[model samples]
Target: MTLATVESGFNGEPAVFTAELKPHRSLGPIGFRVLMGLSVAVTLINVVFFLATNALPVAMFFGLDLALLYGAFWLNYRAARAREIVRLSRNQLDIHKVTPAGFVRKSQYNPFWARFDVARHAEFGITDMAVVERARRTTLGKFLGPEERDSFAKAFTAALADIKRRV
Candidate 1:
């Protein structure tokens, strides 16, 4: 996932930490189009060969394979739209998650009571991260890769500490 850290605030106060997280899309539209074009070319060539050999069923299977591949790419593109936004101000910590289907879930906590929780692994680095406040636990950055998670956790932890110190 893409993790972008930003510093912003309202009025004349000091800037607060904000992070916008999004799922990584390795292939852009151009790349996808190129890949699909190549696939179609290859499938057409196979279809021609199968038809010449009188293997009609085999040609149909090739069409099915192409359809399935296109469907897989479509699903991936849809999922890449999901995102998370985190804002840490002096008084509050907020997490906003938006799914691919446009559903939104938000969690807010008092900065004084919220805790930044992280689970790490020796080989994989940071495996999980969450915000814990009393009985509530809100997970963050599930779509982020290990390195992204590490960077986010460090920045978020520092922001939390700074806010707490100001209290």
Candidate 2:
């Protein structure tokens, strides 16, 4: 549940691996603020120009456009809060998925029985990954990009192998 637990190992066993995955966003909070400020300034300048040219409707629409742009960025930031956490130890593998709205879903598996599976594409690299245990399968790293997914798949597979060897 916490980074401390993962770092210290699960239930006193050695920690194999722990990964907290989040979606990549190019723009940070300050960047977003700066971008919005510039957008507002540009919109205001255009609006004033339209008003001076006797285009009242165009000026109103420019304000509306700025509002819509702000709303879009707000939604993007909200969605960026989503994350996936995976932890593996000698005996257990735990995965937690957290949504932007703060809902958390947890899945557990015995390290010996669970397999880290990846579906690969010749052109696109890793297309999907999952934790499979007999008949049950839980998808993972859906928010990660292709390169991140590939890196995660390699590390997770190695950790799983290490855990299995110890058992």
By lDDT, the best candidate is 2
Q: Taking the tens digit of each residue's C-alpha lDDT, what string does model 2 give over 1-167?
A: 44334333336666679899999999998999899999999998999999999999999999999999999989988999888888887778988777887667778899899988899999989989999999989999887899999999989999899888885
Alpha-carbon shift of residue 101 in model 1 (angstroms) = 0.9
Span of 10 residues, lowest total lDDT, candidate 2: 1-10
Each prediction's TM-score versus the true structure = 0.89, 0.89
lDDT of each: 0.85, 0.86
lDDT of 2: 0.86
Residue 137 local lDDT, model 1: 96
Per-residue lDDT tens digits of candidate 1, residues 1-167? 11222222222334388888998888999999999999999999999999999999999999999999999999999999888888777777777777887666777788889999999989999999999999999999999998899999999999999899987
Question: Which regions of candidate 2 are displaced past 4 Å?
Answer: 1-14
